[model samples]
Structures are given as C-alpha cells and as structure tokens.
Target: MSTMGNSTNIFWQESPIGKLERQKLLNQKGCVVWITGLSGSGKSTLACSLSRELYTRGKLSYILDGDNLRHGLNKDLGFKADDRTENIRRVGEVAKLFADTGLICIASLISPYRKDRDACRAMLPDANFIEARLLEDGLHEHVRQEIQKAFTSLHVLERLKIFSPYLDLISLHSRSYIQPGFTGIDDPYEPPLNCEIEIQQKDGDCPTPGAMAGEVVSYLEEKGWDVYQQASGSNM
Candidate 1:
C-alpha cells in the first residue's frame, strides 16, 4: 500500500499560476493555425507537415482535424447548416483552450463557411491567427490541367492564388457540408488582413512543404515566440 504525503487537496483556491508561467513551460509562444480548404485540398497535409516542424523545434502544438472531431467532440452533429455552425463553434472553443494553455492549436477543416471561421477568429486574440491557402483543384487530372491553363493566364504569383475557382468546385461537390457563402456561394474569402503569416502556394512540379514550414516558423519567431527567453516587450 502507498501512503499519501503530508499534502492536502483543496476544493478551490486563489489563482496561483499565470498563462506566462505555462508559456514558459511550453517554451514557444502559442497561437492558432486555422487551415481551411476544399476536400482533397492539402489542408490536413499541410497541417501535418506544420506540426512536424513545430515538434522538431520543441514547440508545443496539436492538430484538430475535422474528421477526428466528428468522431468524438462533435459526434452528434450532422451536415446541416446549423450543425456545421455548431461544429465550428465547438472546435473553436476547444482551440481556445489549447491556445490559453499556450499550445499552438492547428485546425484542419473544410470550414467552407466564412461566418463560422469568422466566429472562431473573433474568439482568438488578434495576433494568434495564421492562415494558409492550399489549392485542391489539383486533384483531378482535367482540373489540374485547367488550373495549369489558368496559371498561364496570370503571373506566376497569381497562379499560386488559384484557390478561388477550386473553392467553387468544392462548394458544388460538397454542398451538403458547406453552408452557402453569406455573400454568394461563390463569395471570396477575404485574405487575412493582419494575419501573422500567410503560406502562399509555390510554383513547380515538386511539393515545397519544407519551405512553407520555414515560413510558418519564421512567422512564429517574428511574433515573439522565443522558447529560450522570456518575452520582454509585448505578446504576438
């Protein structure tokens, strides 16, 4: 048998630790990485890669993928607009918890509805949001070719920003899961006005996950996520 130490558990007590203390334990500053894209888009793929980089740097982080949530926290939800709203609402709440604990929360969801995403954004701090765009139109051979054609029409930079049409196709295919955009089904997503970082798509035949991860790390660092030293000035 084991004997208890000369310690007592109290039902309640005054606050003892602050978020800064937890942040110290976690090392790196915490934020939320909200990755939204069409099905077949690389939302989860990018999220996984991002998490790997965070782990490599000894940063505390976690990924909240949509499918996994449906199986657990949001198991009772369905595909109706209201249900989708509730789903995002719940996820946002959980993400907030992780962020509060000073852990980088990476959420990969279709999250096609802007209103839901906006609600989540409102719940988090201003500087804690990082948005990345992943073009899913590359899934189909014909569509990929179409994207290639569209790519040529504009400069290489614009080509990487081809998610507009890809999102349209996704909305069409997954109408049930998607709540029609408030402006229009084809409503465009307003780029993050003050996002700490934006991972734009890169050109070329090969994937550039490493470069993208480097950008995210750079943004985290720029935001004052220094695991080794305490924040002297302001929070990111």
Candidate 2:
C-alpha cells in the first residue's frame, strides 16, 4: 500500500575475483561431501580417511566432524527437534560458504532428517553435493547378530515376559513419534536415494582403508575434478 516500498530495489555487485578464481588458485574444485548415518556409524571415520587421502594427493580439503564442531561452533545447542533443525541449517550455510571459496568441505554429522539434507543440497549446486552413506558392518554387525540370535533362542512368550518390565518403562515415555519407514530414535535418518556413492561395511576385494581411499580418489578424478590443473590456472 506504500509507494516507497515498491520503489526499493537491491543492488548487485560483481567481485573482482570469483569462486572460479579461488578454485583455480586452490588447484581443486570445491564441493560438499555430506555423510549421514546413525551413531557409531562410520561417518567420522570416512571423513577423516578421505581428508588424509586427499592431502596425500595434494588436494586441499577440510573435514567438519560433529563433536569437533559442537564443542565450539554449536556448543550451546541441545538435541531437541527444532534445535537439531537449526543446527543443520547453520552447518549447511557454513559449508556452502566454504565450498564457494574453493574448499572441499566434508561434513560428518548424523543429519537425520531427509528435509535437513535436502536443504543442504538446495544450498549447493547439484554437481557439488555428494552424499556418502555409512553402513553398519564389521564387528558391530557380528555383535548385533549374536545378540539377536541369543534372544531368539529363548521361548517367545517367556522372552516377552522377561523384558516386559523394560517395555513398560519405554511405554511410560511418549516424547516422540515415529513416521512410517523411519528406522531410528534420538534422530530420524532417511537414506539417500540415487546417491553418488554408497560405502558398504563389509570390506570386499580391497584389503585396507587405503584401498577404499584410493577408490574414492579415483572416482573423484574420473569426475573431471583436476585439482592440479585448476591450481595451475589460478597461478597463471
């Protein structure tokens, strides 16, 4: 209703040097590697491993681990749903800024909701968003299977009755609700569909972590991200 409001316009300015300039100087393409999974999953492990591997290849990269960030950047936040959402939003903004500056940003967090991850993806370009899944495997799977088998060995009704007290305790609390297809509590994790890559828990033909790192590095190289060329271009 105010004529002055309609006359207001924002101004756009061009930077002397842009993202491509920084990317050229950094000798690598900037992107985001978002790792998601439950607690005790291998998100942090993979992020650290990838950072080391990239360093060995002379590619610049930074890893943002959950505990490391929460200790400072997000120390005041709690685990409430809204707090969780805001935490992820802030992380996404920071990661996008980092990527814009030509740094490969690897965020290892239990970003549970699909909505949160999607929000991150929207902030980054399609070519720059890489979703890495950390699956449960190795010793953890073996332990879980052994426990389940042991529990199954007992008579069904007897087993239920034995754990009835614990079930009663759980039933007494009703702080959260599970949506269909949801698999976890404390946070709800939605697996990525059509992801760029999926890391399996069972080590296959590869012998060690180095082999896995090599595979990832090779994949990134094949994607036309020539860090050396970019860096050289920046210098020229």
Candidate 3:
C-alpha cells in the first residue's frame, strides 16, 4: 500500500512478468536516453536519427518528443513553471514504464530546469537514466536561421519593416528577438552538471545527424546496452 501527493489508499501492483523476462524476450536491456537542450539545438533530429539507427541494428526504441506530446498527452498544460514541472514529471513516469518493458526510450525536450531534470532522473535507476546534453556552439547560426525565417514570411517582414528603426538595436543584441519566458533567453536554463553524455558542435560546425547518432550508439555499445544474444524467431 502507498499514498502519494493528493492520492490516498493506493497500493502497489506487481506484475507476474518480470523485467528480466521481458529483457530476455526482447534481447536488449531497457533504458531511457533523455536528450535536453535549448530550442533549435537539434534534439529532435538526434532522437529521430538515433531511433532509425537502433531500428536498423535490431534494437527497439521509442521517441517522446516534447512538441508532439503537447498535441495530446499534455495538451492542457501551459508553459508556466508549475505546468512545466508537471509535464516533465508525467513524461518521466511514462519513460520509466517504457524502460521497464525492455525498450529504449528517447525523450527529447527543452527541460531547462536542472531541478526538474534531476527529479526525473531520480525516478529511474542510477545507470538506467542516461542524460544526453547537447551543447550548441552555433548560436550565430541559430540567430541567422531565425532571421531568415522571419524574412521569408511576408507578415513577419512587414512587422520587421515597421520596426526597422530598431534594427540597429536588434543587431547589437544577438538575443533581442527572444520573447519573455523563453528558456536560455529570458528564463534560466540550468545545464546538467553530471550528465552521462555530452554532444557538442565542433569549431562552430555541427556534425551530421547520422554522425551524432553514431556517437550515442557507440556509447551504448561501450556500456554493453547494445550487446544482446539473438533469440530464435525473435522480431524486436
């Protein structure tokens, strides 16, 4: 029996099937690879690339993208601090369940708060929760892209013309276009201090998505997560 938060009279339920049994059936150890970074930092791209790579290698993996989840599972949640905390908490629990089922779960999100991320990490076993932090050294490139995107839209271009007098001011501030409450801009984005993996751009040049995925795959192999004996007629 257990009680949590506002709920009472709750009891823990144990499944007859164990995690080891599921791991044997799937022929791979379960774990969660949490990819976190600022917006436009290629977190989603890496998640997709990693998933495809794992699929080709006969490993099962699932992706829980933050924006995609907002369409349904977290539709009602806002961008407020408390709501963001709840969002991460819910996703962490779901990822924990997926890991228990012997599937690799990749969660890509701009989980800016270190405390929130640490709380999620606490929900899983020490080694099972792998935090992959993406340090984007291409801030100028990102700003350029944002400018190009704005100019490509006629409406945005008109707005820019109306504010052309402030163009010099905007040019002086690299992050002037960033709105209030934006993570890494206005709001704080506390980076992970002890993450297991760190992916970064080199010399202002971001590696190809495939190459980044390969790095993560190599890590998994080195950690023995990529090694599994094949079972006859197994299709996972």
Judging by lDDT against the true structure, name the best candidate: 3
lDDT of 3 by residue, 1-236 (tens): 46776778877888999999998888888999999988878899999999988887778899999889999899999888999999998899899999999999999999999999999999999889999988865773577467555434534545666545575455445335544466765467889999989999877688899988988888888888963333346545
The total of clashing pairs for model 2 equals 2
Q: State the displacement of the C-alpha of residue 12, model 1, in Å, after optimal TM-score superposition.
A: 12
C-alpha lDDT of all candidate models, in order = 0.68, 0.70, 0.83
Clashes of each: 0, 2, 0
lDDT of 2 by residue, 52-101 (tens): 87876677888888768788888888677777788888888889988988
Ten residues in sequence with the least summed lDDT for candidate 3:
227-236
Angstrom error of the Cα, residue 193, model 2: value is 1.7
lDDT of 2 at 97: 85
Greater-lDDT candidate between 1 and 3: 3
Among all candidates shown, the one with the greatest TM-score: 3
Error of 1 at 69 (Å): 0.6
lDDT of 1: 0.68
Clashing pairs in 3: none
What is the Å distance of residue 42 in model 1 from its true position? 0.7
Which stretches of model 3 miss by more than 4 angstroms? 139-179, 227-236
Estimate the overall C-alpha local distance difference test score of candidate 3: 0.83
Q: How many Å off is the CA of 181 in candidate 2?
A: 17
